[model samples]
Each structure stands twice: as C-alpha cells, then as structure tokens.
Target: MALLHRAEIRPTKLELLSAWLPGRPWFQGEAAAGVERVAAYRFDDPAGQVGIETLLVRAGGGPVLQVPLTYRGAPLGDAEAWLVGTCEHTVLGRRWVYDACGDPVYAAALAGAVLAGAGQAEEYFEVDGHREHRPPSMVLTVDGAWRATAPGLGAIDRVEDGDPTRIVTDAVELAVVRHVGTEPGPAGARLSGTWDGQPAPLPLASAAPR
Candidate 1:
C-alpha cells in the first residue's frame, strides 16, 4: 500500500495542527495561542486504513518538539470533544477535524509502527511544565529483526520472547511482561510492568494514550 502524504489527507493535516498544538500538555504556547507549521511528514502503515503523521511546528520561540499522530474514521464518534479544530480545503470542499493524541486508533497505530521498524529513534530534551521530559533512552529489539534505540532517564527495553514480550530496564527498576493478542484493533496486546519491584499492568489502550 502507498504511504499517505500530507497533501493527500483531506483538508491538510497541517491546518489541523495549527489548531491542535496549543492544547497538548507538551505545548508551551499560550492557552489560546495559534501555531504555524514549520515541517511535517507521513509514515506508511501496512494497514492502509490508518494514517500516521509526524508534525513539527513553531509556536513563538519554543523549541520544536515532534508530534506524531494517527488518523481514522471507522466508528467515528465524538472526535471533536478532544479536537483542536478543523482543517479546510478550498479545492476539496471538505474539512477534516480530529484530536491530536487522545484517540486510541492513532496511539495503536504509532506503537505498531514503532514495533514494525518504521520509527526513528530520537530524543526531546525540553518539554512544557505539565509534560514529562521523555528522552529516548531505551533500546528495543523486536524478534531479532528490528532495533529501536532510545535515550533518557526512565528507559524501557522491549523484546519479544516467544509468546510473552519481555521488557527489562535498570534505570527505572522495572520488568515488563506483555501478552500479545491474536487480533488487532483496541485489543491488540496487553502489557504489565513491575516498577520498583511492584507489579503494574498497563492495558494496551492505556499505554498508548495516557
């Protein structure tokens, strides 16, 4: 399947980001500030239905932090509740509006892409007050076919060990045990990690968004 480009997305995803950027916890702009797109790119999902976009914007003088997102319309409902705004396309006569990161579909798509060797390893040193500074500090090797290197304080190492996925990290003192689902969608996989020697299970849905 062909990768979805920013131009091909109805109404243009950049226009949507112009309105969405200020609402994120990681956004340093004023509460009602407006944003202008600096650069953007798209990732191709093997599953053609999901759309993934990586956007970089300039909101005054703040450093540029990458915002990766996925889009979908199947079972679409109440997307505007978390929506930043709408994108208007003069030629297409259509508008595409969506939430930047609160959707499960987008989150799952992003995780899937990272596991599929389609994500680039990078780090964000600065972040807004409310947001956590998650520098890329973990290394993930999936099934010996793909490797993801991350850097930072709380790093997570993810590896697929037969039926169960194992995550080991000394920085945060956690061991994650995951159960991969037989199917896709919201029920893709389940993950549980032991932090500080305590058992904590993170549902597949929760791990992606919040």
Candidate 2:
C-alpha cells in the first residue's frame, strides 16, 4: 500500500518535467508544451526507503511518454546525468529526483513486479485523520514465464537510451517503453497497463535475461 500525504511540492512535477523532457535524447518531440499528467502508477519499496512512480504525460497533443521517477532523501551518486532535478517536499524536506532507468531501487521494483506478478501499490489519503482508499491512477499486468522470481536484482550494469529504456542488471534485463503503444510486442515476459480513462491496455515494458 502507498500512503500519500497532502503536502505541497515546489515546482510541481509537470513544471520539472517540462524543462527536463526535451533535453532527453530519446524524447522525439520537438518541444514539450502543455504538458499534462494523464495518469501515474506507483511501486512500493520493501524497505520503505524510496518513492517510486511512473508518470504518463502528454505534451502538445503528441505521443504519451512514460517517465519513471524515484524520489530519495539524498542524491544518488553516479546518476548526475539522469537527474531530473530536485524539489522541496512540504512533509519530507528536500528530495532528489532522478530518471528511474538509472536507479537501482526502480530496477529492483520492476524486476519484482514482473517476475513475481506484483501489481501497482494501492494508494490512500489521510483527511482529518481518516484514511481513505483511492483507486490507483493506472493499472498494470504482467505475464509469461513461470519463473516468478529473480535470484536477486543485482546492481544496474548499464542503461541504453531509446524508445524503450533498456536496463541491464546482473540477473535480468528490463525494457521500459518510453513511447507506449496500443499494439503488443513479443517478449519473454511483458508488463501492460491501462490509464485511468483509457480502457485499452498499453504495453509498458518487457523483460528477459542479459
């Protein structure tokens, strides 16, 4: 379960992404404009140390892009290139945000979700001390291969930039489709999802061994 606090964040998520998205080599859009948050999904960290989220946003009526992000209390070393930017959280103080492709926690979470068939974390909000459950903005599915567990998600060995952000770990390789499509593709294992208002399942990712 994911508990969300009603707190303010300086330079809201869209503001940060607007400035960061265009600069990415894989972003084919000419310029990011009218960026809107279509839907988002979350993954829980077993240790409860990091905040994992994947945002599906559209800019200027262009293609929907998948932006996976991780929030941490401190900066991640050797990830300066992947840094989206930093923001101040009303409840959590300063936060370091990065593109999830390079974050070990994100990789591990994806691995666990794909191999173990784990769904997105359920979200809840606290209002006047009462907790209310809310449906997740996005729903995801995983299939193929009965090996529902990786030995252990190893350190990130490499990351390749492309339509699908490919992450290689010692145990497996996961591809997060930067530009999601309605049509499904071949894969040893697959992860697909539907946005809040969209009924058709969109392919989100695929996984295989290195």
Candidate 3:
C-alpha cells in the first residue's frame, strides 16, 4: 500500500518536470507551453526505502510521455547525472528525485511487477490523522516466460535513451515506452497496461533476454 500526504510541495513535481523534461535526450518537443499530468502509477519498493512513480504527461497537445521517477531520502551519489532535481517534501522533508531508469530499485520493481502481472499499488491519502482510500490510476497484466524472482534480480547493466528507454538488466532487457503509441510491441512482451482514460491496453515495456 502507498500512503500519500495532501501537503504542499514548493516547486511542485510538474514544475520540476517541465524544466527537466525538455533537456532529456529522449524527450521530444517542448514543455514550455505547460504540461498536464494525465495519469500516474506507482510500484512498491520491497525494502520500503524508495518511492517509485510513473507519470504520463501531455504538453502542447503532443504525445503523452512516460516519465518514471524515484524519490529517495538521500542523494543517489552514483546517479548524479540522472538527477531530476531535489524537492522539499512537506511531510518527508528533503527528497532526492532521479529518473527511474537510473535507479536500481525502480528497475527491479518494474521488472518484478511485469513478471508477476501486478497492477498499480493500492493508495491512501493521509489526512488529519485519518486515511482515505484511493483507486489506482493504472491497470497492468503480463504474459510470456517471465516469472517473478527474488528481490533485486534485475540489476541494471546499462541504459539507452531514445524514443524508448532501454534498460539492460542481469535477468532481462526492458524497453520502457517513453512515448505512448497505439501500435503493439514485439514478441515476449511481459508487461501491458492501460492509462487512466485509455481504453485499450498498451504494452508499457517489453522484456527479453539480456
């Protein structure tokens, strides 16, 4: 389960994303005209140390881009180059945010979810000492020989940034769909999901031998 706070964040996630997205080599078009977060999904970190979230944002009527991110209590020293920006979380204090592709925790969680046919985590909003239930924004399923493994199975060996972000892990290779498309993906697709408003399920990532 994921618990969320209604507290305010200076330099909101969208604000930070707007400035950072345009600079990404894989990010096409402009975010300067503003962007809207169409939907989002979360995956749990088994160790409970990291926060994993994937945002679907649309800017200037362009394609809905997939932006996977990881939030941590401390800086990721080795992934400084992939840092999105630090933010002050109202309840969690200072947080270090980075692109999910560079975070081992996220890569592992995503691979695990795909192999296990898992969906977005259950969410709850923490209010004045009370918790309010919320529905997940995404629905995911899986197919193929990909099976769930012990924690930390998918250790990233390398990353390639293009229209699709390819992450090479010890167990498998993942092509994370950065730009939403209607076309189906290659064979051995271990992951498929539907965005909040999209009716047809689309392959979010395809898994294959590394």
Candidate 4:
C-alpha cells in the first residue's frame, strides 16, 4: 500500500485547507481569508489509492479547527452529489477533487484509521460553534454499528446499528470521543462515548461551546 508521510504530501494539506475551508458550512472565516496549518497527520490504508488526513487549521480568531478529510482519484461517480468541495490538485497534478464522506471507500479508510489510533479528539468541535471541543474516543462494533457523543452528550446515540449485511467501508473514527452501536431510529447506528472520563450528554448541540 502507498502510505504518504505528512512531509510527503504535495501542496501541503494546509495549503489545500486554505482553499477548501471557506466553503464549508462549519467554517467561520472571512471570505478569502487565509488559513494556516497548526499541525497535521495521516492514517495509512492497506490500499494505497485512498488517503485520510487529520488537519488543524488556524483561521484567525477562532480556536484551531480540525478537519478530517479523504482524497481519491476520479469523481467518485454518483457520490459526487454530496461532495464538500473539489478542485484541481496542483499537488498531484490532477484536475478533479473529491469529498470522502460521499465516497464509501474513503469513509471506510477513515474508520480504519480511527481503529489504528491515527487520530485524537482534543481538536474536534462542532462545525457551527468552532469552539466546542469533543473528546478523542471512538466506538467500533463487529455488527456494523456506530455512534458519536460530543462533550456533555450522554451514552451512544445510535448512528447505525444492525446486521453486518455489507462491508461498505472498513472503519470510521471521530477526532473526538464517539459511541458505536447497532440500533435503529434517530439514534440508530450512532456515536456514543465519554468526554474527559465523564458520560457524554445528549443532543450534542445542547452542551456549551468550549
């Protein structure tokens, strides 16, 4: 598998973020403002084609924002509909950009990285607040179930929990602590876990922003 070191990435991940962050709904930056990279790291995939990155960006006044993204070749076909942002890769010298969340392959790689301890939760926060921080714990189940719990949010709110009918992706991780389970409904197959050793609260949005 082709594993890229942080130093090995072209155009630098931060450079990519400078152009990418502004477009995100969670981004709290002035239009056209530049973003600086505070720290960065990557998780390796057994297959070299897909890549996962965890990046910290300093966009002026707000607390550092952690953006976890995946990259791949081509348009991801039908998945392009949910793309966060795409641009020509001056680094790889490619013309297309892709969002991993929309790509099953990238999503699975992210989950695997979490399982491999390639990420930390200290830097994670709600996209809107940009200040509230989530802890660094993730829950993985053999039955294809998962969930996420931000600071103050209580036990695993099922994101997806059911039979392991398909192996759409290999893994998933929250930069912060999240719960995993196999249930249904609003809390179905969700993220749930503790923050700073305390039980997470519910409605992750209710907790005060860090």
What are the C-alpha RMSDs, in order, of all predicted structures? Answer: 15.2, 1.9, 2.1, 12.9
Q: Candidate 1: where are CA atoms >4 Å away?
A: 1-15, 30-33, 71-75, 90-95, 119-210
Of the pair 1 and 4, which is ahead by TM-score? Answer: 4
Per-residue accuracy of model 1 over 37-147 as CA lDDT, tens digit each? 544444454455655554555566664444545555442465555554444444333444444344444443434443333443233222333333333222222221122
Q: What TM-score fits each model?
A: 0.44, 0.93, 0.91, 0.47
Error of 3 at 79 (Å): 0.3
Ranking by lDDT: 2, 3, 4, 1
Misplaced by over 4 Å in model 3 are 148-154, 182-186
Query: What lDDT tens digits, residue by residue, belong to model 2 across residues 1-210?
Result: 777889999978888998999888767554736578889999998889899999998888678899999999999988998899999999888999999989998998887787677778888888889989988778888877446454476777888877788888787888888887833233667888987677988889877765
- Comparing 2 and 4 by TM-score, which wins? 2
Model 4, 1-210: lDDT tens digits are 232222344455566667766665556655456776554444454465666554456676654454546676656666554444544454454423343444455444444433332232233333444455443343222222332431222222222211211222222222221111222122123322222233432211001111
Candidate scoring better on TM-score of 1 and 2: 2
Leading candidate by TM-score: 2
Off by over 4 Å in 4: 5-16, 81-92, 115-210
Q: lDDT at 61 for candidate 4?
A: 66
Put down candidate 3 lDDT per residue, 1-210, tens digits, no spaces: 778888777778888888898888767655777677988889888787899999888877778888999999999868987899989988899988899988888877776776555556788998889999988777777777445563345467888876678788787676788887733244555566786578887767766654
Off by over 4 Å in 2: 30-32, 148-150, 182-186
Cα displacement (angstroms), candidate 3, residue 137, comes to 2.0
